[model samples]
Target: MKNARTFTTFALIALASTATALPFDAIDATQAYQNEVAILEATGAMPSTEPVAIFPAMPEEEVAAPVIASLQDVSLPAQPRVGAPAAVGVATQGREVAAPSADIALPAVDLAALAETHDALAVRKGEDGEADAMMMLSDVLFSFGDDRLEPAAVALLEDLAPELEGATALQIAGHTDAIGDEASNQELGLRRANAVRDWLIANSALSADVVTATGIGEVDPVADNLRADGSDNPEGRALNRRVEFLLPDAG
Candidate 1:
């Protein structure tokens, strides 16, 4: 019995020596535990090995992290829509100007020579083109209401012949008093103007093409043909019966 105890003690010492010489990585954990349990059972030990707590390994840290830039550091170009105004930082030279209209016509002006040469003649300005002249007729120039010219009419036209020698345009306009019917007076006035225009072209140096005749009857009157009481005004009637001439611009 004492020899048996000695043999067990020798066996434990040999196993301990073998375990200490071997590497932990070379040994299987399950097989080593089973061996320990067998040894303990065979030796009849009072207690077994206790359980050990195991935990997972910690995650590795990143080597280097990426960097992000701020919004103010980035820049972009501007884009303008079609038909819109120019973008900022752009410069414009000038705006376009419109030309004058072609449809408008300029006014006519008379020659300076015509104005200076005919200063002795009476000149009247009218709204329509050119200048005008009026001549008052006498009772003796024509038999009352008749278109026939008397000896006095011929003498008066002869006196006016020198002043109208080189006139480019001459229009003879006749007027009458309100004593006669409108149609009869219009016809008489026209006939009287025609006689005078024809006489001037034939007897004087004036051209036939430049002279024309027209009659207004009593339509345009310078004086009152009748008094306020509807009575006859002889002087006004006499003033109404007259002839006028118009001379247009030479240039």
Candidate 2:
């Protein structure tokens, strides 16, 4: 009886010690990234406390809290894999972007209701006089000088998730400023669009059929021919660098 009890106690102690938490700062970056990605996929947050390696095991509150704080300032998307140069930046397709047919019956996403009071949107009203809501990717979906989604982008997505969920289809378009050559612009634009498309397919809880990506390269312009401040050379050119989110249009 005495021997059995001692053995049981020893086994329990060993088991408890084995399942210790991870150390935050002690973890190397490479390991930390692996740990964070796994945790984000699992717990939905980064920076965990597990020894040696961190298994995807975090509480719901633990995950949701950080997200709230992290997404407060950042208005763009998460930096996982969205746009950028294909070789170095986010994963992108080559030149020649592919757009969905105008006749495709895609799902509808209410861009206005979704962006209600949300400053992270830039909806271009109807070309004609009408109340229209469209998805605006003005510095909200990608990073500056890079095409990848920002780090806090996921949390931002989480905030806008409902809007995204409401949409049945998503049209990802890539645009570029007129500074670069036409060919480079075209290639860069395609890469950016494809990158976003890939990200939506991987992370978004939407169907691929309901989503398509295209790159316009310097064709579309939203703002005046120049920038907001006083700059003659920056008007339409700067305005050209933008992406648009179109709701389901039968036409």
Candidate 3:
């Protein structure tokens, strides 16, 4: 399944893989933020290949400002819009991203196994070759911005039993729409993802040690913000607001 949403606007759509037909932003601001350190190093603001101790730390925040400002002169789209939905999903094109290719990797798993054995999940191969999958959590799954899973989500958990029981470990990623302060949205997304994890362990056989959850709010979007009204879209933002599942590194 293909999961993508437009948080700047509430919309959703379901597809099997990254399609040439997708209508999304040419550049995602989330990637820009992730690569900021590289940008800073390239410009000589920070030392070569030396990571800062505190990200967005008080003093770092002041230093990051000028580095971010430098991008304005370039043609790339790095403008991050705030004050949208707090939790959103992820989007992937037809091709999978290899797990070892970068800092964050989502692997590609067997699509049939994921669709039938697990929850409604969209699978992908990371650039680094990690097995990555994503599942779209509807507003009905949990109250808007709340992490607790709903009765409907519980039903889905029952279906997920077999897959979780067999996996070595699992990774759960939480995302949000571009509807609030970035810092707060990140925290909110984490809460929601954790809430879902709590539900699975309480009601199912999965162990806590086998799972890890991440929260990324309003960062990676499959739907462009321009036509978020669904006026010209099918699944606008709902698709973007979701949780991703990935295979863990045994290495």
Query: lDDT of each structure?
Result: 0.64, 0.58, 0.57
Question: Candidate 1 lDDT (Cα, whole model)?
Answer: 0.64
Per-candidate clashes come to 0, 21, 49
- Candidate 3 segments whose C-alpha is farther than 4 A from its true place: 1-112, 116-120, 124-131, 228-234
Candidate 2 regions off by >4 Å?
1-108, 131-138, 225-239
Residues 1-251 of candidate 3: C-alpha lDDT, one tens digit per residue: 01211321122112213322555422332233337546554655544432222222223243334456465566542343495323322336755443332233334234336655445455554578754565655464677777777887778767775556655577777877666788987888788778777776777667899777788777765555347453543354666667766666433
Q: What is the lDDT of residue 64 in candidate 2?
A: 36
lDDT of 1 by residue, 54-94 (tens): 11122456556666666776545457668665344433465
**What does candidate 1 score on TM?**
0.47
Question: Worst ten-residue run, lDDT, model 3?
Answer: 7-16
Scanning candidate 1 in windows of ten residues, the lowest lDDT window is: 50-59
Residue 231, candidate 2: Cα error in Å is 4.1
